[model samples]
Target: MMSILGLLELNFSFQLVSFPAVILKRLTFHPDDCFEVRTPNLASLGQEEPWTPNTLSLRLDLSDPSDPNVSISLYFDPGTRPLGLLPGSKILLHNVEHKISKRKNVYCRFINTSVLTVISFPPSLQKRITTDETSFTRLYLRDIRGSVQGMQQAVCSITRISRLTLRWNCIWCGKLFTKGRCAARQEGFCSSDCGRFGASASVVVDDGTAESLALVEAQQVAVMLGLTAAEWKVLKDEVWMRGELEYSYNQQFHDPVADPLWNVVAALCCKASSFRRFNLSFCLKKQLHHQDVSEKTFQLGEMRYATQLLSSPVLFVKNITPSDWKALVSHWQHLHEAEQSTH
Candidate 1:
């Protein structure tokens, strides 16, 4: 099946030329199979100077509901964004270039000959689309650990946070460089030094099922800690000055080790959000309503019910606190204990 996850696994040679217009014009696709827009247009290269030629570069985060674990950043050029494109909107892209960056991030670029169709659903269906896509993409850490393909979302608690390190990558070839030179120069590519500062770190997260290590990039680190890049730099400096930066991170908001039970939605390449609880009692009740079900059958039914609840509109429990997370964890533990006792 054609999916964002599938695209990530496939390798394509780098090409600057666009596909022929004749081929693009004849292509057709179903709206349901098309990738849904997760985030709106983002200026990938920032603002262009007056003297510089107009590039009109922007990116959109798009994912297919069939494979919600993966989302691709699509860059647009040579034209303005399509009208009526918004989050939850579906888009069918044709003749886009797929390239792997220096960070091994897979993304698509819309060239001059690319064709894009913005598919907007009805007002009633928009919420359903968003809920279904979000729920499908969100999985437990255990479930996502073995997946070798695309980015998977999980609501996990920070078990451990590592120290941040400063890194630089070439803008032209997107290659990492430490010495003041582009490695791509040896391969006859651009020798010009176009370095950009980036912060990198890893964090261990647990979602009660399993623990997994997740890498936090520059932008995500700032968002996950509720701080801007500049603020994070200042805090890092302070921590470095204290001579404790090698072992621990400064607790400006909440200590990751002490307050490890956070409700933030974490993914490989995404920002964090405020804590929120999800109600699964209705799902349990619904599953238990079926009488005379075998233990195995009941367990299967419970899983189905949980999935249904996640896809439902009323699943999100907003503005939840750390204490609420503790209570929720205890409640789950009790439920598991009761189930074991019954067995």
Candidate 2:
């Protein structure tokens, strides 16, 4: 049975009990077998109201001097999804409807009539938050472009694809390769020579608070080229394989308009009021604006600069080509040509 300290009569059908107030710290659903949420009962590890076995209630920081009341937890039934409830959201609930379970623990029911409002994260309250590793109370998107200057880590979503991505430049001359043999190398033309076309492109993703270009690397290009080469070889060898008008590599590579799958991918990556955790390093420095942004945006002076961004991938990618593979092939080809000249 619920050992309530006391209960007071209310105008509503149910009585209102004066329980300690609390700020929400977390609301997660972990599958039990397939992360199934168990029914809340008295026999649960801690005889707490509004918590099932799968809720796994642990990450809370309750030292707010603004409202110094004891912390309490709340639970919504499986089907009931509170629209705006999030961690750090303050709620005032006059919830009180007692029911006794088989395990003899008193369960407090927070029905729909309870007064709950989700408050936006208080930006000024950031000062009260410590630099604790496990603390989620601090950090916002606006401050992220500055706060994450050191080796701070935060979760973010990969939101939009950047057209400026996938630029292929000559490894030697380091110029945009549109056409013409690269002066730096003999075989591959300058990346600029390829024009503004590529299989993989850059993207902008954000953790709820801060946005950055999701980390890009040279290998992403190699993945695209490798896929193209594989598709080309397959087409050359196979007699019965159906011919594809567009290259197979094109399936994964497309503009935001041409391919809609990336839009779906972006949505899947975002969790409402939740983010994927990543260990990351960040450095803040002003960089000269890109040609695309420079032309589109107005500038005050010739030396216009904005924050340049880069990040590493938490997602694993395949190693389509090893670093030394190209160097070895180029060396052997040059040596073979030298021998032929001597002959």
Candidate 3:
């Protein structure tokens, strides 16, 4: 009898009030959950309105006839994505009405649906991305944490603190190197020679016409300055002849042998912004003048004497056919000792 009475009471309560069933599919958002609603009766509630033009609004319908306030929560997945649902968007809604009339009976009803906008990250495939450093770094971190924990353990045996030094390995040539000036200074490219690119014949120019000859000579000078042979030959015969009249017969009209090409070579090798300073300094030094000074006064000139240039160890190093850089080192060593003895 008591169970029957309880069932009847539940039925009566359900008939007066009902909750809408909610289903979340392919869940993306998780933070935006709580929702609130208030109505005098169910007949006054309305359907939901769209939140943004890009987003669809969610709606919840109530089954109760009583005008009661409601508060609810919802959930979805949260992962980072470029577009679609972000961290903070909103929800929209209005009211609805239902009516029933007949010859023998009359009734009125209120109904409504609430609108909700999604706010959270969506799952993506980028989570699987890995790099070598990151992977090794994670392993290192794990081992370090374990080691620290072991050191802190009360029952663990204490070992003498031996200072193990740091070390690194080169990525390119696969060589082990100790922690020192070479490893700390360079980015694991064991030596400058290892990173140096081999010299190749870069550009070929026409050899027939007088103008072609001039262009070739210009290109040869530029090659001495470290411009690629192909690049120096880019200004062809016709262009050279067009500007040829500006040069004079007495001018010698060769690329400046006045300065060691090392300055030009290093200037071009460095960054673009610093190029202007080099250009201005080269221009002010009268690099194009080609005037000859006596060999006796060569060492006394403003560092541009042709013999001084010809004697430069850089020229001796680059122009020779020797396979070893040690030959150049040997030549400089003799020259340095000679200079010291004279002094």
Candidate 4:
């Protein structure tokens, strides 16, 4: 947390890429498996890294949702967003990334944490959404995993949290990297704004009946593990550079034997003791991965986050504090202005 708090005082500039795209669409995409979108079209995106291999596209609704040319196509990757979106719904898009294909086609891409938000709630039924994770009726992992079920959602605690990404972060800034750059320089980065390193983390969620492997990003790990992004960065830096003990944000400590973090998660609606509980809404999906296939045969990883996070918190860490994300955004805007000045 000190790393982030220290960042705020630095007055460093960040470059923001896009504003929120609010559009009304019929909610169309490829595969039409769940019949979510009424109208669908063939897509030619998501054929590379940082993009879903089988990405699909949706049209941006304009001119009362009847005119065709008023809508532009937006591409999305599967399992990285929430499901249960109905047809003919108007929605808002945030944290969306922009890309251009080799054919010069514009692609508005959404990866993990990209909310395919459903905003069709009626005024009468429009209550404030709860921040709590949803609880599932099926209490065991075996029933949910081994069932011949259509779409299933459950609430489960995190049995084992992974720290592979946190360990492999940048030595100085402690930021993790994707392609060649760290997240700080993801869009527009100055030499002084950030550094880069490579890492990815996943968690094993066990509901006693079975264990499912979840593909996780760095931010989610900090939240569930109960440390601010800045603290983790500093803790990682001190451990790697200065050879110090782990730092905990909530508890304010620098101890070697103790892993400083909170062990509880909830907003009181469906609270459980020990680890945090989350509403896991997902269906059985037979996804095709290139490496998973052995000798030209298909492979399955059992039941996993082919399910969505059901618009809830997973671990005790709810949201990254404003200082964490907000500081980054503001930093980027300054960088954008600087780049414009040079041009």
What's the TM-score of each model vs. the native?
A: 0.27, 0.29, 0.14, 0.26
How far residue 226's Cα lies from its native spot in candidate 1, in Å, is 2.3
TM-score of 4: 0.26
Residue 105 of model 3, lDDT score: 23
What's the lDDT for all of these models?
0.40, 0.34, 0.22, 0.36
For model 3, the superposed segments whose C-alpha errors exceed 4 Å read: 1-219, 241-327, 330-343
- Tens digits of per-residue lDDT, candidate 1, 241-268, equal 2222222344343455743222121221
Would you list the rank order by lDDT, best first? 1, 4, 2, 3
> Model 4 scores what on Cα lDDT?
0.36
As a whole number from 0 to 100, the lDDT of residue 215 in candidate 4 is: 43
lDDT of 3 at 343: 75
lDDT per residue for candidate 3 within 47-108, as digits (tens), equals 31111111222223211112223222232222111111121112121111222235422111
| Model 1 stretches astray by more than 4 angstroms | 1-137, 145-149, 168-194, 229-343
Clashes of 4: 9
lDDT winner between 1 and 4, please give it. 1
User: Which ranges in model 4 have alpha carbons more than 4 Å from their true place?
Assistant: 1-140, 143-153, 167-193, 196-199, 228-230, 236-274, 280-343
The TM-score between candidate 2 and the true structure equals: 0.29
Q: Per TM-score, what order, best first? A: 2, 1, 4, 3
